[model samples]
Target chain A: MLKDGRVFVIPCSGIGKALGTVGRAAMYEVVEKLRPNEATTICLPLLTIGDEAVLKLARNNPCISVDGCPFQCARKNIEASKGKLVASFMVTDVLRENKDLKPKAVTELDPKGLKLASILAEKLATQIDEINNNNR
Target chain B: MAIVKDKVGVVSCSGEDLPEGTISRIATRIVLEKLRPNDTVTICLPLFLAGSEDERAFARVFPTIAIDGCDKRCAEVGTKKYSGKPVATIVVSEIMQKYPYLKAKSRGKLSAKEKELALKVAEEIAAKVDEVLERKKRGDSN
Candidate 1:
């Protein structure tokens, strides 16, 4: 179980496309590998379904939503559940910034897709660090 | 029948209201990571419902299994609505009815019985994957 006061990382549960997969991959990289101690994951669907525990967690802590596309499901759901969103990242914006790194597949990421996820993860980790430092 | 070069797609409702949703998610992971690693892929239902052309296109081309948490059948309904009908559908409610002895205890985390039930569902899905792929292979041979 996630403790209180830690930054909640919400990744868009968009498993349908490459961009969504990239967003999920980057989110895991940040929460599990990069800042495991400072941040934890809140399942996005739980927020949508009105899970009180998940909603309470979002309400109490600062959240970072990583959205895969323009629909902004993660961001919208987090806010709808009354959570405080400190920052948000869009995988499309990352692709736009690095035009050459086009993802090859949706289900399984290719080298470029993995690279894109790494780049996004790095950026998200930096934001998490900033939030953690500010709170301290 | 043209041979499909890609693997089957696994779409789970991952619903939050019930432990069944958690089961669907974990069961999907079991199939993707353990049971049929190279033969299956994941399709994100949120993006598909939100109008992703890539997701729709992939679903249209590949065989898919929809693992739904409840009778709401969001994953199954969404897949059928936007793309083609799912090759296989697994509903947790039906699974519970089939095996009344196995009850999921928690929505946040699966208990031992819940994990076992989830694995049972995963094995069922794996078998479905084989069935779909085999049918496609047979079609290609004809």
Candidate 2:
């Protein structure tokens, strides 16, 4: 049961490019489409932890860390900030669900990744809704 | 006198966000500011952990930057985890701590001051990167 309605969708900034076609697609579908009005999607090169805008949002809302890989930088960053993370997702987790995606190594940005991202986004949205409902 | 090779990496750890006045980005921008277009840099992040090959190629080509939002160093640690040697590390807390009002109103976005801070941090990083490059050149000369 969570009281906060915010979703923090963070992807490990640069590495996501490797998701190539699939990764790009996922970014557009999930981040562009499902990122809640109350939420924001942040992307930066591996360096530059959020400047001020990121801190403001993180300090107030429940966080959702999305990593393109297992390192889970997005999730780890939140935890390090001493903020509570309400949810989490990984790009690999999405890839796991769609075994047939066969992601390429070069990371050109693909629609398959977008489709997977959409699916993952939908899953997270549902989870958030459930949590929000439970809190009520 | 310096025993450790001055390695630097830029990162943005703004917890679930694209850090605007991000020191890491600013630092990167500064470092690359003078670099020729043929000179490429490798941007490493925790997200690319699975892309081992890509990571290697990136590191092999350019210096690394690690930008951390909070104290966690998500970007820094990720770079190290993948064996990408980061010469410099920047934390967002350091910036926000110095300027508490940046968080005022809790809009969850970067303020103007924050951007200024990020660029400053970026410049600092650029300086460090130049220092390391010089050292590497010296080492090569020797």
Instruction: Report the first chain's TM-score for all candidates.
Output: 0.95, 0.70
TM-score of chain B of each: 0.90, 0.63
Docking class of 1: incorrect
Relative to the true structure, candidate 1 reaches a TM of 0.60
The 10-residue segment of model 1 chain A with minimum total lDDT is A42-51
Tens digit of per-residue lDDT, candidate 1, span A39-111 = 7776666565565787888999999998987888788778777889999999999999998888966545789
Per-residue C-alpha lDDT of model 2 across residues A61-129, encoded as one tens digit per residue: 665666665556556766665555788777677778787765553323345544565676677667656
- Model 1 chain B scores worst on lDDT over the 10 consecutive residues at B43-52
Compute the DockQ of candidate 1. 0.14
Model 2 vs truth, CA RMSD: 8.9
Residue B79 lDDT, candidate 2, scale 0-100: 61
Q: Residue A10, candidate 1: how far off, in angstroms?
A: 0.9
To one decimal place, how large is model 1's interface RMSD in Å? 5.5
